[model samples]
Target: MDMRLEVVLLPVADVDRAKQFYAQRMGFRLDVDKPVKDDYRVVHLTPPGSGCSIAFGVGVTTAEPGSVQGLQLVVTDIERARDQLIEGGVDVSEIFHDATGLFHHAGEVDRVPGLAAGRASYGSFASFADPDGNGWLLQEITERLPGR
Candidate 1:
């Protein structure tokens, strides 16, 4: 069997705010943002150059709005990634490294599954959220990452 990522569903209480954050702040392209019903809206956004997009709305319930726990979008250069988010007015953290390598930051990060005993990667990254607290990790892997 073979599989590839197609889309992700993010939960947010305020669709408009979530949409704005992704589009205006994160540079995600607004692929869809329209009314599905009264007081309900569906918003979809894709990274600047990505095939996958994240879907969010007011009524969907895969997870509670602002309840998205851990989501990481890996990149090649974390510093540049963090800079872009900062330029967009998003709050970020200082860069740090560990055994695995180096990493930036993301909402309260826990040990990623299968990471070495006490190693972190070097990449300027950080955590930020949507209106409802859907957390995200914008990471940049400077050296060879585990999965790569």
Candidate 2:
């Protein structure tokens, strides 16, 4: 059976503010914003080239705002992506790479300054957080690994 991930529900204190951040600052396309019931609302947004979208609104989720962490957005060029986000008023972290040749170490332990030598795929990363402190990581992956 084939299973495709679709939407992710993000918890936020205010719907309009979160909508503005995603739609304007993050440049995610606004897909839906509607009141579902007396106290229920649904808002959906999709990133520029993403198949999976994010949703946030009243009565959508019980998770606490800013509780979500370590969400990742993969890009072909880490520098360019980080620059765009910064230009869009996001406070992004300086480019860094992990010392380990494999996946990055959690938190900030193995982080090294600057991009990996020769812009290595999956080697470089930058991070930022939304107004409510929803953490996001920008991972550079130019090529997919075999069988991926």
Which number leads on lDDT? 2
Score each candidate by Cα lDDT. Answer: 0.68, 0.88
Top of the candidates by TM-score = 2
lDDT of 1 by residue, 68-142 (tens): 755777766666788888899877655443323444223434434333233334433455666677777765554
Off by over 4 Å in 2: none
Residue 90 lDDT in candidate 2 = 88
* Candidate 2 lDDT over residue span 1-148, tens digit each: 9898888888889899999999999899999999989689999999889999999999999999998878889999888999999888889999998887556677778888899878888888888888888888899999988986
Superposed Cα RMSD, model 1: 5.0
Worst 10 residues of 1 by lDDT: 111-120
